[model samples]
Target: MTELLANHVCGRWQAGTGPGSVLRDPVRGSALVRVDATGLDLPAAFDYARETGGAALRALSYAQRAKLLADAAGVLQAGRDAYYAISTANSGTVKSDTAVDVDGAIYTLGQYARWGAALGDARHLADGEAVALARDGVFQSRHIQVPARGVALFINAFNFPAWGLWEKAAPALLSGVPVIVKPATATAWLTQRMVRDVVEAGIVPPGALSVICGSAAGLMDQLQPWDMVSFTGSAETAAAIRGHAAVARHAVRSNIEADSINSALLLPGHGPDSEAVRLLAREVAREMTVKSGQKCTAIRRVFVPGALYDAVAQAIGAQLAEVAVGDPRSEGVRMGSLVSREQYDSVQKGLAGLMAHTDVLHDGRRRALVDADPAVAACARPVLLGTRSPDAASLVHDMEVFGPVATLMPYRDLAHGLALARRGQGSLVASLYGEDPAALAAAAADLAASHGRVHVVTPEVGRTHTGHGNVMPQSQHGGPGRAGGGSELGGLRALDFYHRKAAVQASPAVLQALVPA
Candidate 1:
């Protein structure tokens, strides 16, 4: 009986042209909605964004654009209940987890608004008195950042639909560029709802916010030189787009946020008796359970000192086992279903491959329900792998089993742990669990080249730990090498990408005349 939503192309809701695909509840194998792009007018959508939406956004000043984004956030905040009811069918997430995707979006909007205010009126390049080139006193110079001449295209991932869309959307709108959002097929319904609310609120220009629910066919073919493209998903997909022939020919700027084998290191001093050790285990388990470990930033590896490997593994295993798994709607279920049976199988296959390289320390293998059908939802327990291989990089570093699966490796010292952590080529984040400031600093600096972000965890940060699976609005959430070399949501850095920069120089008299006095 649940009604599914469609894409918001141009100024209104639309249906696709091809045979539609059906979206199923992850907790229950029931049809949530049917989605398709068979009839979508891609050319018309692009034109509308360029001519209508892009015009209006560009017409407004930076502050004006931010006000529109803030208003859009207000609308989303008011309709969060609808989002929760719809999101419940996707996976098992606590209220806080949903907040990270839903409410966090509003916060991101606010952050972008603040960024606009900080940019000041003239976009000041350098502050100083003007130098006199001649006795007539005519020459001068100054720098400014301006908006690009086209729209921004955002292709989002499935896990945190609301957060992903808003994170990219907030910056684009704030930068005075309209946006075209293509939500991942798995969770397009949630994005549809939010976009619909945004449109109805009339916070932005009619053509400024375009949406496509299905295939992105013909979408890239019509891009202009001034436009920018951004994508978030697996490394394989990101690489494909970055290497797309059109992208290269058009010299289009592409930003990709890809999945990485993120890791966490537990220092040697943290024993089973240490509260820090228990806290680390708890944090690791929480990361696995939240969003059913569907996050691109999820901790796929755990590094522990050799002396505490057994204790760390056992503690983490027991905690992961105790996690309640079932329908996200059910009262006690702490972990939810995989995005789909396809993803569930992928997780299993990845785990099976990992088991070949490492020992299975804990197997939370069991069927979790999908809806009320009991056996329909595709679900699996978090798989824990412990490796004794002398070369951790060759065995564990190359193989990344995405899902709730994580491989725990042993190291002799802080230096050894740092070396092991870097074995994964590169990661989006690396978290260290220890109270030792010296050790944390040394290891973090050594591994800094491999990770984009690193968090040092202690009891003081326990309450607001954001977990290893979560990415904040202010952090750079992408990795290098295998993880994909693109970043998303690093405060103002996210906004500036939409606009192209060029330094203009001329004689003082000429520049003064160009500048509107």
Candidate 2:
């Protein structure tokens, strides 16, 4: 029997009771651990965080809380190697992928910490200068932001255990609110270990940060009005969470980042010979293989000019063919397996659904593996499908396979391409590749309305441009419609999600007392 991972609740580690769900290694198909929360007290966990953890964090000034966050980042950064090892076994991610999650989490925490300096020592943040409410200016009105008096519940996705936990926890903790993290059961071990490190380091107060592994059953029932819930998963699950009795009745605040069928477009002037076409082809392939295309921000749709359709498709297909799929630890393996057998089946089903309307341009499904057995590991080769009649292919725009797969479509004109891109309803990101600066700018400006972020890929910036799938702390990371209508991680704006804003009307003397000197 493998080790049964423990849950961190109320400042202690407790072993779970009864038979638990088994977690397997994606690359080797071996049982890695068992996760359960049978005996844990969900209500008590919530109360402890609110009463104990929330109190502790609230007592500290903004600067003090920020310093603690910086300290926690240092501890996690020192343990990066151990996290990479765990990610390879559980998430089946290559070295680069692990860095993106682990290193990115650490960097985000540090950025938040440094950003705290601008917040000052004030416990309450003033929204703006005072406004005169009376003729004599004796009575003034001012708006202020304060940390919520309740705890934050973070329901994370399995695709990014480390990054997901840190990103949500950092903002909540910085804003003086306690956090209760419920990592996706399939990959909870890495998150569990991270919480353990932070706890042992003693950088955060007891109950400030907690983790619940296994099932999320009864967790939402414990939420209060002041409590906030941040979730990242499928749009279907997000809808279910929104409809939960506790959420709907008590009006518990919730933020969601759900399914996104992100798209990448190549402008008309960029043909096969243009550097812009090459850059776009490379970016699409990179998004497909990285994290096995499990990212919500990954490009699922590629739009190209009708004249350059075959040229772009063949270029991307050739790039996809060179990608090696096998065990993440194997030498020269660039792409790894899906997170589990269930995910493998899901991707195959999605591919079959896509094949219904689109023709296969590149089929790597039958390709030979490097060091692992395709039958034993949860591996699926990258597949690319194409459709000339994108308007007729409803499934291509609506479905998100969530694996190493993408669909290519040709548009008659820029207007047609924009229409096809908007068919995703809304997306986390969209990329426009072209040499003509004016054309790229115009397309990006138009796409901005439907996307949270837009990338303009040109030869000059191609060398330094962060790829489409990468999410930085300084940019908003949410979208509208199918992508979930919530925004987060736009620098200090992320703090707004954790804090409540209100208007304060009082005498000028009282106003001065309310704001820090």
Candidate 3:
């Protein structure tokens, strides 16, 4: 019998009733573990999270809840070795790729802890200065935010099982909302192990952090009016989650991170030999191969000055050519297999669809794997596509292959480039590479309405700027429109999602007393 990974909820671990689903190793294509939630009671678990976990967390001040996050970070940091092993085995990620998920989660949690503690002993957040409702100072309305008396349900994507869990949970827990995580089944072991470690260490209050694995069949069916749901996956599934009764009728808040054909633009005057162009080429290659381009923020489109198109392609192709794809444990493997066979098939389908729309400037798919068998491993080499006709390449701007694939296109001018970037409709991030500060600023302003975050990388800051796909906790991680009109992780703003804001019309004295000093 395959080892069944247990679900942790209601202060204990329990296995599902049936044989359940088997999760295989993507690199070796061997059945490694099972995840089954057939007989677990979700409603009971939700109730416990609210009644027990939520109550305990809310009873403490923001500072106290923040300490819980800090302590949990310590616990996970101490057990990171196990997480790395599981990441390589189950997700087929290289050591550096695993660090992005594991270390990134640890850093984000610690960042939230520091920020939350700065809030002091406040139980609620003051939205703004109290506005006078009366001519005299006798009456006024003060908007304050209080932790909602509900639970947070996170349905995470496969590419970031570890970071996804903590990125959502850190803010939810800091805001005094208990969290129940449903990690994508393909990479549940890493997420499951992290949750178990935290729970066993008693880092979080009982029922404050729970994880459910296997089928997500009835998970959305268990939401309440006071609850919140945060999902990271396809736009189709995001739509279904949005229309679910919990959200449509009961008014449950939902944060959806759907399809985003994120772009990177090279500002005018940066020739292929310029430092700006060199930086863009290196960053593009890094984003494409990192996690095999499974990241939502990974660059899917490249918009460069029309004159420098070929040079840019050659530079990026050269960088991508150096990457080795195989089993992560192999000595020289820099890229690993996709999370599962399903992802491999999906990327291939998406790649084929886009290939018909663009020219394959550089094809690494034919390259041999380092130590992995073609039939057993789900490895994918980086492929760069290009098109001379930007106006007609609708699929290039619309489709996201979600693998080590990216399409490069030429734009006439800076304005034209910004317009081309906006063709993505909306995106989580759009980076601008240039030496001209004025041009960079102008292009950034133009793209702001269509993108959630703009990463401006100049030659001066090339070494210091965070990479394109790296989602920092200080900046918001979501975007508008097709990218999913969701907002998260803008420092204290993240806590707003788990909090309910209300305007209290009361006496001046009472209004002042409602907020922390």
Candidate 4:
């Protein structure tokens, strides 16, 4: 029998009482481990986290909690090699792709640690200077941000089990809040292992961080009115979470990262040989091929000048041609399989729907899998679809394939391109590529209303430009509308989600004493 990945709840590792669901290696289709959280006392877990873990964490100064986060990062970094192996077997990621998830998690944690330390020993943050309420200036009102007295529940997606866990945990822990992580069952191994390592390291208070795998049933029901939940997954599931009693009736705070069809736009003036066109093609291809394009921020839409459509497609297609899809351990395999057979079928179904409104620019679905059988291996090849008339194809504008797939659409000019990009309704990011500063800025500004981040790439940036899909900790990672109006990871702004802000109206002396001097 495969060993069940135990759930860490109520400050202890507890095994499920029933036969568990099996997690398999995507490439070999072999069972890797089992996970089941059934029969665990979730209400007790939530209470323990809120009463014990939350109290212990909230008692620490911001600087102390920051040090704890740094220690946790070190624990993960020390065992990084083991994470890489798990990513390969369970996440179906190549070495480079695995590094993005594992290393990215470590980097985010360290960044938060550094920032949290700068906040000093303050347990609560003054929003700004106190405002005088009386002419004598004796009475004043001060706004402050304090750690929530409740727990944080993270419902993560499978594409980035490692990064997703830490990106949210870093801020939550630094803000002196306990977090319970429910990573996607498909790729929970890495999350479970990382949490185990950190907990055993004794870096954090017991119950400060917990991992519950398998069923998410009754998890949301465990949330209290003051507790919060950060979810990343399909929009449908996000809706269900929002409607749950804890959020709908009890007013439990929620942040959601749902379906986003992010885009990359080439300024109208950029011709086929222009740097803008080259940059857009390169970045879009990278986004599609990276992690086999399972990223939430991956570029799903490409907008270019009408005259440059064929050139853009051909350029992106040529680069994607070099990619070899197969087992991650296989030498020369540039890409690996989807996280599971279910994801494989979902992508295929989405691809078929997209094909109805567009023509195939580069079809790799027929590409041979390297060192793996096509029947069981859940691999997919990079595919680019082009639609000349994007306005008519409403599905192309809004649908997110969520795999190594993208749609190319040609626009009349920059204005037309902006209009089409906005048709995405809302997105996590949109990149503008052009040498004309004015044109790039205008396009970026226009896209900004809908996108959380606008990536501007000019020839001057050259190789220095971070890829369009790289969700840096320095910038915001969520978007409005269909992208799920959730804000995350904008440096210190991330701490806001884990905190509760209030305006305290009191005497000047009392207000002054409430926060750090």
Candidate 5:
């Protein structure tokens, strides 16, 4: 019998006693692990985090908490090799892709650790200078940020198990709140392992962190007014969580980052021969194959000038053609399989929906495997579809094929490209490629309304610029409308989500006492 993954509740690890959910390897379709959370006390887990964990964390100052985070990062960094091995079998990601999640998590923790310096020894953060509330200066009003007295429940997505857990946990811990992570069941093994590692390191207090390896039954019902629920997944799930009676009635603070049809645009003046055009093609192909396009920030829409549409399509197709998809552990395999058969089917369904309004340009459905059997593996080819009339192809803009699939559309000019990008309702990111800085600037200004972040690719920055899908710790990572209307990872701003700000109005002496020294 396969060993069931354990759930970390309170301060100890316990194996789930209920029937298990089989987690399969994406490359070989073999059962890797069994996950179950039956017989687990959901409310008791939260209570442990809030009372035991929260007390321990809250007893420390902001700087002390920050140092703990730094120490935890060191421990995880040392275990990178072990993490990569797990990711290869569980998530079907190439070594480089795994580095992005594993290393990215460590880097985010380090960044938060350094950011805590600005927070100083203050237990609570003062917002700004005091303002006179009355005619006399003796009476004034001030705002201060203090950590919530409740636990933070993080419901993460499957694409980034490690990064998702740490990114949210780092800030919550630093802000003096304990974290209870509910990783997506499909990829919970990696998350469970990481939590175990953190626990064994003894860097954090016992109940400071916990993991629910199976269903999140009765989890939301345990949320109090001061508690927070941070979620990342589909828009449909986000909406349902937001509407939950516990959240709506008690007004629990909830943050969400949902699926987005992110786009990369090629400016009109940048013809086929331009470096900007080549760069755009390269970026589009990279985003498509990276992690098999499971990323929510991946470019699902490609908008090119009407005159250069064919050129862009040919360039991207050629680039994608060279990509070898198969077992992630095999040599020379650039891309891997979808996370599971269910995800494979979801991608096919999304592809069929886009094909309803467009024609296939590069069919990724049939491809030569590197070292794995396609029949058993949950693999899909990187499909590139094209539509001449983007405005008429509502499905092309609205639907997101969450695999190695993207649509090539033609726009009349910059305005048309911006309009077409907005047709996704909203997105986490959008990229514009061109040599003309003025043109790129203008396009970015217009697209800013609909996108959380804009990537401007020029001849100079193209060489040094990070790829379009990469999210930095210094920048915000959420969008409006269809994209969840929440902000995350914007330097010190991220701490705001974990902490509550309140206005303190009183006499100068009383206000001074309220403010952190």
Candidate 6:
């Protein structure tokens, strides 16, 4: 097996102190890589980032830091082919699907770079002249932007390892803070490869970046007042990290993006024969199968009008039937296995719980594999469970399978459908299908309280739609409550985490003296 070593401190790579961990190819069920992360010195890694790396990064202006991010993006883009090749081993994704995550990062970095360049050298800006109280003709207060004198610790999830890392990377780096990433063990190899490519590019400072492949032992122990921590994973995990005593005592910034039970609403305007209905059907199936439906924003609950339940179910069922499951590297194969047998088993357990709560409308093939080795069990099907009273709130809210599984609940009417969609307390995203402007507006306003992102799926956009489950770099990716009340990506909003906004109380003439011209 190919060995994946732990990359720590700045520009340093090492072998683990304990026996290595083997990562298997989900499709072939053969070992693909062995990762070593034992004896990984978390304290040293954290110190290197804070003391050495943070100084190098913070010394540069935001514009210079953004340029570094842009240059790194170019280097990473040149190596995109290699990233895709490595990702296939994990399975359940197409080249296009991978691009959405990988390319999205590049796009985000590029955008942040431009934003920083626009900041110029202005530290304090005069909103307007305020009347003075201390002295006659004297003014006070100006908005000033200052970089935090600390490091950003990124704890990423396994599903979208690249995107998760970049979502925080662009914002924090552009805001003039160094980043230390701790990728999920399951997919840390891919992240390590990316990190290696960046380091070799020589665009970033020596200590501006670091990676840890194993447990974050003393990393949290070394956090300081201005340090920032961002995590993308389960709610429980995010909560634990937020509650870290060291982090709390130091008043470090903590951002959490957790997995949530998101939903999609189907409005009443679209007829069975309408193009919009067909498009929504395809979108639903795609979300169920894409990434083996391992995405945090995947449509966990799908709501349809009671009169159109059968039509929606039939359309999605037919679309899912054509999905070929086998090795992703093979031609004509649309879907692949989960990250591992352990993940497959976990999906099954979640599906069992979902099955108990609702009736199955379109249950995907689970008994046997279709195209791959018969001995090997593939990931479960694109499930469509049916619920009678979706508006009841207790039936379908907050239920998520985190796999190629979703529920289709029939609503009494348009108003009822919106209410059903809001049943999920808070979500990363929710998709709506229909052409009725009034209905769409009402639904969006009602569900806005629960969902962090909303997608209006229509025929015009659906024909060229990228699907409902995708997350972009410019938009906020996290949700409220169940989705971890943390925000990621929102342009400058993300950068605020790595920066501290300070109000400077001084005369315009004094500010002018502080910043010439």
Judge candidate 1 at residue 305 and give its lDDT: 77
Candidate 6: tens digits of C-alpha lDDT, residues 312-342: 8888888888887667777877777777777
The predictions' CA RMSDs to the true structure, in order, are: 3.0, 1.1, 0.9, 0.9, 1.2, 2.4
Local error of candidate 4 at residue 391 (angstroms): 1.0
TM-score of each: 0.92, 0.98, 0.99, 0.99, 0.98, 0.93
Model 3 misplacement above 4 A = none
**Candidate number with greatest lDDT:** 3
lDDT of 5 by residue, 1-517 (tens): 7679999987899888898898888878888888998988778888899999999998988889999999989989988888998898889999989988999999999999999866778888889988998887988999999889999999999999999899899889999999999999988988999888888999999899999988877788899898999999998999989999868898999998997999999888766878988899899999999889999999999999899989988999999989988888888888988888899889888888888889999986677788888778877889999999999998888777889999999988778788999998999999989887788898899999999999998888877998899988899889988889888888878889888889988898998788845
lDDT per prediction?
0.76, 0.91, 0.93, 0.92, 0.89, 0.75
Where in model 4 is the C-alpha error above 4 Å?
Answer: none
The 10 consecutive residues of candidate 2 with the worst lDDT sum are: 116-125
Q: Which clashing pairs does model 5 show?
A: 364-381
Query: What shift in Å separates residue 356 of candidate 6 from its native position after superposition?
Result: 1.4
| Candidates, ranked, lDDT | 3, 4, 2, 5, 1, 6
Error of 6 at 428 (Å): 0.9
Q: Summarize candidate 2's per-residue lDDT along 191-296 as a digit string, tens digits.
A: 9999999999999999999999999989999999999999999988999999997789999999999999999999897658789888988999999999988898
| Candidate 6, superposed: residue stretches over 4 Å from native | 121-137, 366-371, 374-378, 391-395, 464-466, 513-517
Residue 108, candidate 1: C-alpha displacement in angstroms: 1.6
How many Å off is the CA of 79 in candidate 3?
Answer: 0.4
Q: What's the CA error at residue 246 for candidate 2, in Å?
A: 2.2
Pick the winner on TM-score between candidates 1 and 2.
Answer: 2
Please give, for residues 373-393, the per-residue lDDT of candidate 4 as tens digits.
Answer: 989999989999998998899
| Residue 23, model 6: Cα distance from true site in angstroms | 1.6
Encode model 1's per-residue lDDT on 1-517: one tens digit a residue.
4453667877887866556777877766778886677777787888888888877877777777767877887898899998887777664355656777888787888788777766544322232333555566554454445777787888888888788888888888887778899888887888888888889887888888878887777777767778888888877877778777657788778887776778888877766778788887888887776777878777878888788888889999889878767677777666777778888788888877778778888888754443434456666677778886637436567766557888888887777778878877878898888887897787778777988888888878877776666677778777787777777778877766777665445577565654445
Cα distance off (Å), candidate 4, residue 96: 0.9
